[model samples]
Target: MANTSNKVREFQRKLYLRSKQEPDQAFYSLYDKICRFDILWDAFYLCKANKGAAGVDGVRFEDLNSIETSGKLIKTLRAELVEGRYRPLPVKRVQIPKDNGKTRNLGIPSIRDRIVQMACTLVLSPVFEPHFHCNSYGYRPKRSAQDAVICINGYLKQGYQQVYDADLSKFFDTIPHSRLLDKVRSKVTDRAVLRLIKLFLKAPISEPTAKGKSRIVGNPIGTPQGGVISPLLANIYLNDFCRKIATKTPCKIISYADDFVILSKTPFNSAQQDWIKNELEQEGLKLNEDKTHIVDMTQVGNEFDFLGFTFKYIVGFIQHTNYVKIYPSKKSQKKYKDKLRSIVKHRTSLTLDQLVERVNRVVRGWKNYFGKVGYPRQVFFKMDWFLVARFYRWSRSRSQRRSLYLAQDAWNKLHKAGLVYLQPTKMKTAKVSR
Candidate 1:
């Protein structure tokens, strides 16, 4: 572990130095190496081992796993790349059911498609990672929704009064392909690689309809919703917009993909709002007017959900001032509860150990996510109570009538066994709790 840590630190130091000296050289070298047969073979094997899903071509990982088959596959891919005849297969579109009785469309790229995308990403990431703005935390390595929330909290601590929550309407789907390609062309000049990217972008698509018909169509604009490279391209395309906003506006913007919140010391004037709207429009993007609003955190005092976190200004009685408090949003909490309820509802089908294992899995994950927020003790207590209550309810519903002590005991056993864990913390001293 120590050696690994030292190696990582050394690599980071080298990358930092190289980025300062020649920004594009490192990426160009990596890209050149990645295109080599040995490196591509290694990448292909890695992708196959990860069990990447097949694309519209229906080429499974197993078919490409063997030495003989992988060699043939690599040769064919290279030929296609050299001849500029490589075309991404149509993405498999599927709808995933959401909790709100709605379905979200997901595009599944093929195994070969993913292998190529992953190889490119591996080479490009080191170069692009440093250029991404600190405020923009979407689809980047070593960052998450929580990082954006934490950034916003840091700004709130510095006396931001209002937060303008901006939502991009169909951001990914509406990105003009020409504009995206223009941005890509600025950074990458290799004709063959550019051709490969163009092929990926302009690939034909087929979406299944409700009537069980496949509608073949061409996507001349927006990136494919579920393609491996879409998020990376989106980030690159939006980086310019984010840079422009940082340079021109007085507001601090925190973005996670299409969701953005602009924090300002004062509410945005009409001109400022128009400037933002116009900037996006120039990029062929539109703001979702219904979801965009300037919130006065001090006045409203109501929690606003952003990136799964509930952000609100709570009065600090101890300090006699306002402080931003973050918690798991009610919607997220409800989902957790609903999942637990489902597990408890089926508790009779499982053994005691299995039931405890399931509960512990859920609780541990919940704590890992929400425990970082301030004043999580009360929330943890509530969750504990909820679990105990559900267990009792499940028992009583079946006329078993388990004692409250027994139910509590079961929870305590899980808690003590290190299955269900919450952060140990003291309650806040006299503050408005929400």
Candidate 2:
């Protein structure tokens, strides 16, 4: 462990220093570095440790959990790469239900391919991290949604009047492979690395054909959402985009991958919006017209939603002073409330203690995601109240229930039953250096 960890750190340090010293300097040799036994092992553990479904190849983590089997697999993978016989297979396609009654498409890579991707990312990430947008907080190391929210909160406090809510339609699916490779070539001149990336980019999709027969079809142009390297690749593709906005626009932008909103004192006019649209189209992307809008903060009743939270100016009746506050959007709240109701309803067969345990698990997860937002006290309290009401009402109606518990009694009973209750918390402003 010590030897492997030290090698990984040293390799990353070298890549960072070299890339930093000569930003545009291209290297023709990186394949060997990426394929090193130590680096591949490090990358292997990275994939094995994280939970994911098997790819189209149907290989799961349990199949390769043993150190002996995993080591042999890595060796075989390295040999294939060295012999130039490596080819990534078509990705498995799956859809997940979104909150808006839609589905999000995810493509799963084979376990072997995932290891190679992780290996490549482990070597290339340090070289590329220095060049990505500082304010872009999605999917990067040491950045989180909380950091992005804090940035927006600070900007609003500084009196940014208008929020330009921008949404890229099918961002990941529409990125032009040619353009992305060109961007990659600007700094990464390694032929082997480029070839591997191109193969990954054009990897076909295994999808249902006629009569639902599964077959590999269509050369996908964008990064697969489930690939280990997709986030970094996406950031690399969008780095130039951030620069363009800085150079050409009057607004300051903060982006979390595809979801980005620009803050400015003045609203973007028709011409400016058209320019942005044209810029996106030239890159094989388009703006989502339905989701794009300019939020005027100066207006009394106007609010705009960004990154799952709705930002609005609230005026107190006593002091009559306006201040900026944000909370989970109404859509998000409703979805969560429905989720809680469904959980309690679906766990009808479980004992009270078992049901409470399941609910607490979800409550903790929900709190982790939404609890840190600005001015979430009232929202958190309301959510707790809603959960309590739903659970107790359902409990009292149960035929096997012992006693009819009052509201306060129900709270105490649930507490005694090990139910985890969410408490109101003030949002902490996190500072990130540019």
Candidate 3:
């Protein structure tokens, strides 16, 4: 362990000297530099300190953080990377329940695996970030689902005729391992790092069965869904796909990870879909036919949901002139209501104040998100009323014969006390002129 520490210190000193000599270059130019003991330790510390979970190995962050074992652990990790003896443990598969009575499978990697992956990402992402399309928002810093929605909204407001929403079917799971490696290799030349990533990609997965047994299965294709490095790799792999669509077509592509919304002045024809299908097939990816939809944004009453914002072209009279109002969708209202109801249902054990606090948190965040995109004032009012009714029901169930006034009084009290605040009614609208 002492010898490993000395070697790590020497590597750091050499890195510092090289940086001084170059002066303009980024520190640690080569991929092998990422395998240094201190770098791995720092990466491991960051992951463990942030409460990163364990994988199928059952090695917890706390175990890695232990003073008695951390040195040995770091030493072993360094040796594994340097000697190319690293083999990723099986991913722990868990199913998370979604809103639509469906389950999303998430793959949890062990802390050790996450540390190595994160270290590689720390080195590789900077090289990849500048190359990603400006329209692609998935997994990029300072870019988000809302940003994708905003970009699409901007194009629509600028008179784009239609929006075609498409998502890849089992995107992470279907990405061809060899193809992804080829893409990564095209940009990153670090042999050791590449080998480690290969191990992660080809690692078998342990899926939990309904009968409480675990099944170990080989995953020949696709990266693990929930692994730390998965999103970055997915972004890199799809960067070309996005570039191809952007360069060959007039349509603008806005991607928040695998979810893609193509904006154009004309509707997508079968030929365009076929082209996209063929492009995706080349990389061993396919579109989810069930989730794909094409909506003409120029036509009145036409609407589509993307990145949680429902965009619709509503014709309205503004000072005797008919103009289209591209506003947040009604579906957003229903979604928010369902979310509030779910919160109320699950948090019944909380006190009235605690419950109000929780509700306010959700309301504030939801309002901030949709509010930024010009969600209607009426929707905010509807949300407040829904909450009022929910509060009344909660009060009624707790105390027999609690009057409507009592519930209303409590609602008003929460607002007055600043425990809860409704979204403002006079928010600005992003209406487009015809």
Candidate 4:
């Protein structure tokens, strides 16, 4: 099983290198690669492993349980692709609330569609991954948000004393379909593959109504955020932007999907910033002027936040020597703490065991993510402190008003319930570098 799992997808690797070498050449008949049984087989497992909710079609992973059943489904999809009979279903539309009191729209594709998308992305990623700029780090294999943060740090330490934060307004929703399709056509000339992709691109939406019925509506632009291929498609759409900023711009640029931050030796004034905005607009992208700005890092006490980490300078205690400091941004910390608070405060009706289990899951995941960079140990200490107080209050609320030893009793009760929290430390913080 281990060997089977570890086996390389050789066709993908070879094609990856081939596309890397000849990025401009459009090769026809590449659709057959995605239709390979092995590729679909791997994609089936990937889709199963993800275990997401059923899409607009209501076909769940459990519906395709065994090897034979899963194989049949894959073979059916392969046949549909080979014979040019595949039809994409309109994705299920869902809305998620944002931190800024707005809701972000997501489209959930069917399970079978997800498998196809996965298979396509697995084969297609190799073809496009090599051409993507090093600075573009979202949704790519191996690279991560930490790598993007590391990039900014590298540029900052190398005397890039200015920061330009570029916010693309409604980036995913505003992508020009014709332009994106043209970009894809430049290299991916296979009619079948292109057709399948276009089918997805033009997929309408199945939006659920208040009466539990769903309505089908046209989606004229943008990829659905929740679909498996959305991120890859987003990267493809902005591939030019990545190449342009990384090559043409004088400033150092690091991006995660639509979030671009420019590091420069000289600060960009309003005129230069507007010029940059015009250039991006020419590429069919627009900036959110409200959230976009530049910061001159050479000046004392100037800093910026990127990818949940704050890039600023610290004054050393012994010699007053100054150096760059990277830590979990305050916004990130507050959001994490609020999540923790919500779990305990709202769920106090549950048993201590149940509440602690829920809380522990969040605490562990948060620590693992924020612990990647910076001295967040102090931050961890504060979180644990905050948790203790919240738990103590929760414990107090559960007890009798007649209890004489409230503090000690609550402490003892919390200990007995086996609640988990971070252990504060002064040791060296874990760091990730590219």
Off by over 4 Å in 4: 1-8, 209-212, 346-349, 401-418, 424-434
Candidate 2 clash pair list = none
Tens digit of lDDT per residue, candidate 4, span 1-434? 21113333677678788998887777687788778888778887887877888897788889888888888899899999889888888899888887789998888899889988988888788888888878899998888898888778788889887888878888888887888888888878888888888888888899989998889999898888888888888988887876776677677778898787877787677776776787789768889888887777766577788878877776756685676778788889889889988888834578888888898898888877777876677778878777876665676577555333335555555667766667643322221111
TM-score to native of every candidate shown: 0.82, 0.90, 0.82, 0.90
Provide the global lDDT of candidate 1 against the true structure: 0.71
Overall local distance difference test of candidate 3:
0.73
Extract clashing residue pairs from model 3.
55-110
Q: How many angstroms is residue 354 displaced in model 3 relative to the true structure, after the best TM-score fit? A: 3.3
Best by lDDT: 2
Model 1 stretches astray by more than 4 angstroms: 1-20, 23-32, 37-85, 97-102, 213-215, 394-399, 402-418, 423-434
- lDDT for each residue of candidate 2 in 14-102, tens digit (9 for 90 to 100): 98889888888877789898888988888888887776899988889899979999989999999989999999989988777876688
lDDT by candidate, in order shown: 0.71, 0.81, 0.73, 0.79
Top-down lDDT ranking: 2, 4, 3, 1
Query: How good is model 4 by TM-score?
Result: 0.90
Which of the two candidates, 1 or 4, achieves a greater lDDT against the reference?
4
Choose the strongest candidate by TM-score. 2
